[model samples]
Target chain A: MTTVLHSRLLNDVLRDILSPYDLPPVEDVTTRRQLARTLLSGQDNGSFNGLALAYAVVAFCTSTEDGATEVLAAVGDNADVLVLDGVRGGYLLLPCAQDQHVGLARALHDRLGSDVWMAVAWASRRDLASARATAEDVLRIASCRAPGVYELRNVLADFAVLRQPHVAERLARMIEPVVAQQPLLDSLRAFISEDGNRAAAARRLDIHRSTLDHRLRLVERLTGCRPTSPRALLTLSVALTAHSTPQVPLPRAY
Target chain B: MGRGQPVLFDVGRLLHEEFLAVYRAAAADADGWEDAAVSVARRVGSRLISAKVPVAQVVVALRSTDRLLTEAMLDDGGDARALAAAGTALAAELMSAFCAGDDDGLADALLAGSAPDGAAAVYTVALVRGALADRVVNAFRRHGPVLLATSGHLLLPVPEAAALPLCRDVCAELGGEVWFSVAERPAARVALARKEVDEIDALVTSLGRPPGVYRIDDMLFESAVLDTPEVRDELDKVVAPLLANPVLVQTVLALLEADGNRAVAVRKLFIHRSTIDYRLWQIEQLTGLSPVNPRDLALLGTAIGLSRTNALG
Candidate 1:
């Protein structure tokens, strides 16, 4: 069994745990003090006892308000859990069996249906110091993918591979020289997609095989990469994906 | 002071919520309990100001909180006069913070393109003839426009259906030429709309077109050509021979702008109708494409549009 509290409620409980009455002055004293003040003025006046408030993964969350509460209540009713309150949503603090939590998340998803987007994070109880960081990381990774229960390890690896700085810079440096030549760029994209098949790429571009070959030659001269090479093909394919993909903006700040 | 009673009530309600939380801390044996309440008040004041709640409404909310705190103190058998003095002091601190927050919110709104979220269309106004920017802006606001940003290029959020009528009214009111474009898209997409607006405005300016509501969607082909440099370059090459002669370029441009109406081109250029017809024939002889034919007119219009608008991207 483990002890955990809701992540959002941490900002509130942090005030009480790190108040001037409870702890010595620390490095982020000003920020702690501000939080403590906000907590004092907030409407949550409930008290806590006995349970050790530690970190836990948010296995799933929904967008709607009542749906979230119903799911939280249902999860609490079925399992030995604490349904902690959050300002915008609720969190489930599971004390035992991580599988039981995942099971509950799945059952909740079934109930909420596919319309609502759910999120999950990779967090551990022992990593209390990095709880907020873990939660934010999961949220960022989740934003890039579709709505579902996200497994953090795989998502993190995928994100790291796709977003490596040098990979992006190399792709851009090669593709920048051909951006203005729409027809050549289109042909290059088709050729890369068809696995460097000249016949297939020509059909896709609706051009003659000779025309496609000529375009490939021009592309090689422009980007300094041969389309026929496997390693070069992967880079070109990934480059086209990166070029065409629209970057979703972060959520607006108040 | 500019806020209504409902807004004041909203401020009071939110302040009360925060006050209860502060009261809980103060009632406990926590150190800095009194300072905590002051901090809470300041934070709440700042939030109200940032939300664009009026200063007077914030003052009313603070006063209401003070009254509630005073009543609670008396109920707890605290000295009434002492509580009153502390309440007055707290009120003064909160009011000062609230005013400071109001100023900060104004600055932030100016820096960010802060507006109500339901803005459906984006309008960019580029004032050309006179210093009538304020008058044009006030008219848009009167018709429920949310001013997103202003840097000479005024970005506003307006409804799509209301855009043309509103633009027509403003153009009539100002009584002078001002370049404008309306992009009937979501407000969040205004960055793209800004580019479209700039292109349309540039197109109007280069054509020496009179003040009117120019929808960005009207010049769909021209806009596409403008965004693609290679396509524009090709079109420029196609029209290069005619462009070499400034008079012929002007004649084709005038004819295209007049929508192939020779009489209209004649009137616009202050030349005889026969001269326009002769120029059209000369244009055909030079390029092997007559402006009088529908298919040839479109091709010629695109080429001329590319050559005429040097300001296009």
Candidate 2:
């Protein structure tokens, strides 16, 4: 507790930094704060302390309109960690152990019947400045994970743990590729689905498999390839999970 | 005015817009007392919109009450009759809303109607009283929607309909602007206004409420093949008229039921030959229908059955 970044300080700093993005007025922030406080205050009731770990904070919710209203409905039950990541066209807040974010992502996908991204805290450094340095390291592993899925999570978390400027620059880079590649990847995914198999992918594409293969080869073949070795499948999986756009997998035979 | 689309309202936006709306409505009023009312309306409207229910129709209901107040304040002749007329109109609107569906609009309506200065408030009283009396009441039966906008009330439409002129008329008197929002929504009828009631100094103004309220059972029975547009149009032309001469229509129906046998249906209807024949002629002229075609005969039978059935009952 002594070595770790202080909660009050971190809360103050993050609240200040994110102040500009708060468009619904300070009232919304106030309401959220009050709600968090109320939830935290009922520690004796066990509902509040039941959800959080000793040094961790967690808040999560599900938009019940997705035809799966029952998932995570019980107020008392909660996962060890909580974070938000993009899913389908919107976003979802996920909860589980940092280790279980992967499983929770899978469960969320199952419940909502959609792919979703997960951003877990790999580490929480003392200062925002130092946290940003740590984020740069994790984000470099960005190629192995879905692009913006964890970067924003990492930046937000790191900024939560440490008040460094690095979170912003790194987050800016993280969101740029996601926003850019979204449409291209979206089109490519549709083409793959409609094409059925990769062989069919070529015939309908009016191109040889070699051309299509060359494109896929590039996803793993690039020089700064975080997803290059043993990580190619992992990277593609994260990308697909972050968004429901299924990758044109190497089609297996019957 | 731009297009027939409802102003999108979530809880946050609804509250914001409602407050803004109240601010504007209060500002629009040359008189300042209505600001308090506008404030309440703003709050309630915000909550309803956040719940994401279609309550645009509610605006009009409140405005109707406001218009009545304005008209009364004009100190015009028959002011009592005008206010009474407004009350009936508001009542009728609330009744229509309740009868049409399970009321998700009640909270906003109750809050708005709680005020007592104007027509909207009075209508709310009428509406609450009416809803309490008959659970399965008609549309616009309850009165709260009108009271919310009793002060400087403008005839603002909710669903895709033209607002009542009374709202604009009263608004004019109060030096307020009547901003009518006509949303081009698909579910409701277009440009449809509330029922008209001729004033009789509060002595039971018969609100010519919408005539098409069909209960579930009524709809189910009307689901017969004759309800098809082709058959329905024919009946609307033919059957709507014969509701007058029950004996004549019945005799004609009996004759048709008996396959146009003058002898057998005469016994069926206990009518004279010439009487049946005369009614048959009227039926032919009105329906443009001959008893000869099988389709026309089936249509007649079905229409007669449906028309004779008490829809409200």
Candidate 3:
């Protein structure tokens, strides 16, 4: 009887340890504030090597009022992840090493389903605030990607262009005239997507080869960027990307 | 005070006449009088702001001044550049005073320029449009002043904590069709916040998201993928052939809209199950993408969204 009771107690403890939802949420405002302060101040907290921050936005088919709750529950107790209230969703902080960041993000994505866009960043406790900002930037640059886990490294080039919004705006304007010409825009998009295989592009558009050539020439004439040249193609491609990217205009002082 | 009124009126008249005179002089001489014209315009701007005149009225007055100056300069065959320069100087000084001299405190300061004093507080900037914008403006006025931006958009600034609930309540009260684009920023960056919210609205609208509240954070994926011309191009290509056959296109859209449930799509399309099956197969054959597959369905959904936006244009 004694041996059986001990065995049963051991099983119960193991169950608590293995369960992802074992850790109750940090519900007290004061406790959460203290935790945030401690993590942000870079004090040596024995539980974590670094903080992995994942900022996400979830669009629900229904009302989004409970989005934060859903996101928090989805994050669960995995690696002592803490969910803080944010704009549309929540900020999830995982106390883990660098190598586990991607896996943690993936797990969150799986739990949250397809409607969530998340960007993850790993930083030392000292850089926690900056990491959060970086996560936001990652979200912006990777906004075009399918809903999943994204990192700054994956979107560095796009982020670089977006950082200098004026340059990006100018690049976008370079293709403004082309945007109005649907046929030309379509041709350019097709040609680029087809890797400059004119014949393949023509087939994709279901247009004659000569007609495709005419459209390409019109694109070049209007945009001053030759489609057939490799260097100009790179410019055109970046311009197209910039044209679609949202820009934050500089503030004006009266 | 009564005697001062006519004196002010005479000063205004004298200033107007002097502006015309200087414009005429500069048109011919192209020197010396330009500075005088600028100085006179600056004084006029200061006087207008001091009188607490509305910016719109000031703009109208300036337009009339510009027309008169232009006519006078034209009659004298004056250099058009000189008249333009003077007009710009007048406009600049008026705008500067209108922004800087406003006594309405934080709202006015943020609208005119950044405010370091308000930097400690985070503001949620809301941009609303459509017929509902008026109602929203009326509702938002209880919290703070609402700025009327161009194109009938209303800009409302509220505290960060109160923003979400307030916007949600407003949206609910007005119904789900009402949409608001909101951005949270520090007081010093409210100007950029306006643009940020506007961009969010534009992006989400283009993606065919239902009318509701949207923020930059909520629109990351849609802005990243649906707005990217390259991705749209690729997706458009996938559906281009299907577009030639409206029946097939409709069938595919129905399937996507139904979330790939064949029975639901069949009911929605008012077609038999076999018909939807055949169309799905046809779509797959034409686009080399299967609608039954989850991954392929997402791509097709985005492709159709792009197609619809393009068609609307």
Go through the candidates in order and give each one's DockQ. Answer: 0.01, 0.00, 0.02
Q: lDDT tens digits, residues A1-254, model 3?
A: 01111222344334334553533444554455355545533453545322223212211111253644566666554434554544454455565444456665776567663356677776655666666655666665555655677765455435544555565676678788887789888999888677566899999999999999999998887766667643345456656767886321111111
lDDT of 1 at B222: 45
Report clash pairs, candidate 3: A143-B220, A143-B224, A144-B224, A144-B225
DockQ of 3: 0.02
RMSD of each: 29.9, 32.6, 22.1
lDDT, candidate 1, residue A206?
Answer: 92
lDDT of each: 0.51, 0.33, 0.58
Tell me how far the alpha carbon of residue B228 in candidate 3 is from the true structure, in angstroms, after superposition.
4.4
Clashing pairs in 1: A40-B21, A40-B22, A41-B22
| TM-score of the A-chain for all models | 0.43, 0.29, 0.63
Residues A28-64, model 1: lDDT tens digits = 4344334323222232133322222332344234455
Error of 3 at B158 (Å): 3.9
Q: Which residue runs does candidate 3 get wrong by more than 4 Å? A: A1-254, B1-113, B116-120, B141-156, B159-161, B226-229, B308-313
Give the best candidate by DockQ. Answer: 3
TM-score of each: 0.36, 0.19, 0.36
iRMSD (Å), candidate 1: 21.0
What is candidate 1's CAPRI-style docking category based on DockQ? incorrect
